[model samples]
Target: MKKTFLAFVVIVILLSCKQKTGIVFPAQWQNDTLQQTAKAKANIVNNLAIDNTYQFDSTAIVSGCGMVALQKISKDYRYELIIELILDSIPKYKQFSIVDFRDHIKITLNQYSKDNKLINDICTDTPVYSKDQKEPITFTAIEGLMTITNIDGKHSPFKISLTTNNLVFQNADKETFLLPKEEFKDVLVGWYAG
Candidate 1:
């Protein structure tokens, strides 16, 4: 009886120790699911306001490498506003003060000809214009800030919030153009480079 009880106990222990097969998930499927979840969570909010006046709820925003471009054109195509930013490196999640990162940041506004054949005028950082134009229209970021909220991957989705004070630029023809304070909040931009 003792031997039989011991044998029964051993069998019970072996049964309890037996490993059960679990539902196995493929590695690729797991990775894909994780990526999908991340992409879903990183929602893109495209909102831009200039001087608290001209508001653009949805604008075409694109980015590549260390550059970002935000463009808006009128329905009639008579007016166009393009704000481009060139950074020294890939933007990460951080806030950059225009005053300190002035050298590393380059912003530009381009004006095309009536037929869109040539770039008739441009307002940009002093350095960019200095190379091409004898007297380039230039503007400075007196008071501004740039905040990068997310950078998923090298060629993935990202978000940025940009704000600047009044910007003044003088054209080659000695015309003064004033760009009022601008703000871009939670703008959804994508990186297109590998």
Candidate 2:
């Protein structure tokens, strides 16, 4: 009886361990915390239209190739954004530094169909030289259906797309209804989960 009990306990323990490992996600899972954070940071440009109060660090710039790390405050519930500033400092030419001339700031929004086909893409030229330089870009949301598409991949069966007539961006001399910083966190949380 004692031996039988011990064996049973071992079996149960082993099964539990296997279950935990099965649920453990690899480092690159799309919905994983890291991916979510990167998505959230990238989504910051969208958030900017909602809230202008939230300011990003000059070092939080994104590059064509870079590392983005994310942390989940709640499981698929809330998240924090952290960015490792990697500026491309390579010399493009003998006279000018590549990093110095790169577009330092950019704001953009995009929508796609369920087929992974891009429907619309809008972006503002990011200003690099002056902090006070105003961006004349704006985004407006249109009322419509948004669809996500399945691209060739072994990952999640669905990608994200947006459709709405409400989104809009325009230049404002003072704080306007379209530009508020308080909506940043909530907008991100919704987009991250949606």
After superposition on all C-alphas, the RMSD of every candidate to the true structure, in Å, is 20.0, 21.6
Residue-wise lDDT of candidate 2 within 85-190, one digit each (tens)? Answer: 1223322113322124334212222211223311111111342343433322332221111111111222232221111122223333422223121111101111
Tens-digit lDDT track of model 1 for 19-67 = 4533344775899899997765443112112221222234423223225
For each candidate, the alpha-carbon lDDT, in order, equals 0.45, 0.28
Give the best candidate by TM-score: 1
Highest-lDDT candidate? 1
Clashing pairs in 1: none
- Model 2 lDDT, full chain set: 0.28
For candidate 1, give the lDDT.
Answer: 0.45
Q: Candidate 2: list runs displaced more than 4 Å.
A: 1-16, 19-21, 25-31, 46-194
Model 1 regions more than 4 Å off:
1-66, 86-100, 112-155
TM-scores of the models, in the given order? 0.37, 0.18
